[model samples]
Target: MPGSGANKTHAVVEGGSIFIQKLNSSLWAEANEKKILLGQLISMYSELLKTIFKNKRSKHVKDIIAALEVYKTHYSDGMKKAEELLQLAKLPMNDAKIELKAIMELRTVLLEMNKEEVRRKRRSRAQNPRGRPNLSG
Candidate 1:
């Protein structure tokens, strides 16, 4: 429900012929520019991954799997980012695909990080669960 203040706000907006609308339009165009840049960054990282695992296959399979898991998570998160940017800018959905891709790639890295950490902790505990026996004792 629009209040009296709301009515007045509309009136102010309506009074502007071209300038206000253009300003509002440009705001989102700027946002899209940044969003695409972020996407490009993601693409670059994906390329890096390709290079790292380009040749060696079997040895790093577990690592690659972990990384792919992370990528999946990040990709999902990227979709969420895209949704959010759309909602925020009130712009069309087409422009945000790249940013969303970046976001997902980030998720992939995070997944790998989590899996690696879990394995590391388990190994650490197996090696030394109690610690050096409290020297004071």
Candidate 2:
């Protein structure tokens, strides 16, 4: 009865352009956040590599750092591309496909970074059975 009418209203709003635009905006915000996070991770990895090299250098750590730098560049480029796509999506034509493509690309990059992060964590955990260093202490 009342709930059914409310559900219908919800469906109407969800199907409209305003809802789509809002969703796209949210995706854009998430992409930007991911880009910032990637930058921070790159900086941290670089610092770790520097500390490692100062004491005992390992080819594995150097390789991981190199890979992370490449991912950072890729993620940055994806963020720029997403911004351009957002501008294009706002044009009169209002093509949702462009926005969708941009979101998909960003998601792909995010997935790649997540996978690499998991791998790095696994390797670190394996190397240190005691687990990650406690920064709080």
Candidate 3:
């Protein structure tokens, strides 16, 4: 939960690399440079499974469990699509449109999240322009 309240902005950078920036901070990283191993993924998935089991009443618990199982079956396809995205990123923008539906969808999701973050920041500023309590009696 270290980044629980921090906003992350993801970007596709030069050389087909993916970068993530933490808003209002100097934290930044090239995400794609670090390959996530199966062990790490399995550990995270196991943690999620434990959490779901502990919170059986969580909304859509059954559906979430089922989706996690199904994701295992499509691991190869996911890997392939990720590779295709990396390849596509190396090409010129115009020539990169073909067979990039997944990447485009991902881009859409990121853009929407970024827009929401911007909207939330605007609302926060409007609510408290000084970024602190008025502290008036």
The prediction achieving the highest lDDT against the true structure is 2
lDDT of 2 by residue, 1-137 (tens): 66697898998787876433643564446655656545555656677787768777688877887887787676766556556767967765456876677677897889999999999899878777687675653
RMSD of each: 22.3, 20.9, 16.0
lDDT of 1 by residue, 1-137 (tens): 66798898898887875333543564436554444434434545556666767787565764765565566555555545666767868744466985687677888889999999999899767776787554453
Full-model lDDT for every candidate: 0.62, 0.69, 0.55
After the best TM-score superposition of candidate 2, give how far the Cα of residue 26 lies from its true spot, in angstroms: 11
The candidate that wins on TM-score is 2
The model with the greater lDDT, 1 or 2, is 2
TM-score for all models, in order of appearance: 0.24, 0.31, 0.24
Q: Order the candidate numbers by lDDT, best to worst.
A: 2, 1, 3
Could you tell me the C-alpha RMSD of candidate 1 in Å? 22.3
lDDT of 3 at 45: 68
Q: Which scores better on lDDT, 1 or 3?
A: 1
Residue 63's lDDT within candidate 3 is: 64
The regions of model 1 sitting more than 4 angstroms off are 1-99, 133-137
Question: Model 2, 87: alpha-carbon shift in Å?
Answer: 24
